[model samples]
Target: MYNNASVNKVFLMGYVAREPRIHNSKNGKPQLSFSLTTTESIKTQGGDIQHSEVHAIKINADAACLKDVNLKKGDMLYVQGRLQTHAFVDEQLIKRYKTEIVAIGVELFDPIQL
Candidate 1:
């Protein structure tokens, strides 16, 4: 029996780390790939320090979507999507895993000063 009680959603708001890459899917649809850097501040005896993490994002849509939104590097971006993990075997027959967000919606906002 299945209860269907599992959720794997993710929401990320951060600065684009680099230019997004566009690729063609097997069916010829466009796929956009990019990474965003999110920061967290930790309070310590030496005062607050910032730590950042980069997340890989993938958007499956038309290339025109990029132009319509004018998405580019250094822009503040908000993404709504789900987390996915990919598994593969390396040349050495070792198994590797990667995790990424498959974006369902994306939006741009003015840069927020940290």
Candidate 2:
């Protein structure tokens, strides 16, 4: 009988679309941002169709952690994180919202393994 309403967790396993961008937050904390691409094959009445989706990921960590990971383009990564929505005003003074995955843990596998 324990039901928690606040549940926001996400797990994604895919290829890195590009090199991760490293930047510092307003509080001087190191942050990383990247795009992950996931693909799936769907079978319809006609035939199988391949579909792909890209996700924006953000990670808040220290410089040492960033240096250790060294994520690169085309690398396979497994990310465990939570969904976060950010609202901000664009240059045109229009309100915009973006949802991204705030990674709590990330794992990198060598290309040779698979």
Candidate 3:
């Protein structure tokens, strides 16, 4: 990963693995955290089904749009932004690495218009 390039951006569209919640940073910045899950299913001609799943991504959204849209589990969301890595220490001082989407923007996913 290149640092200080300012070009490490990406967009994702998927379902939430869990509910979303809002919080404030110590410096008063707004943050919304949630998880994302991507899945794909296929049905064989013989009536058999197969599925694939992806681990959730922790996403943090800006506060400006937090109060505008309602984030719920299983809701289809369109997210646009950069990919970021967050680190933390767990219960017993175990180091954990998490990849999160630092959202630049988000919106409800509507397929009817597509």
lDDT of each: 0.86, 0.88, 0.70
- lDDT per residue for candidate 1 within 1-114, as digits (tens), equals 669778889999999999988888668888989999999999999999999999999888663345578778999988889998999999999999989998888888886553
RMSD of 3: 4.5
**Candidates sorted by lDDT, best first:** 2, 1, 3
How many clashing residue pairs are found in candidate 1? 0
lDDT of 2 by residue, 1-114 (tens): 658657789999999998898898778888899999999999999999999999999898663345477788999999899998989999999999999998988889786897
Candidates ranked, most accurate by TM-score first? 2, 1, 3
TM-score of each: 0.83, 0.86, 0.67
Ten consecutive residues with minimal summed lDDT in candidate 2?
Answer: 61-70
TM-score of 2: 0.86
lDDT-wise, the better of 1 and 3 is 1
User: Tens digit of lDDT per residue, candidate 3, span 1-114?
Assistant: 777665777666778778877777557765777777765567788885656444344344554545578889888877777777878999999999987677767777765665
Off by over 4 Å in 2: 63-67
* Superposition TM-score, candidate 1 onto the true structure: 0.83
Residue 33's lDDT in candidate 2: 91
Kindly report which residue stretches of model 1 are placed more than 4 angstroms away from their true locations once superposed. Answer: 1-3, 63-67, 112-114
- In candidate 2, which residue pairs get closer than 3 Å at backbone N, Cα or C atoms, i.e. clash? none
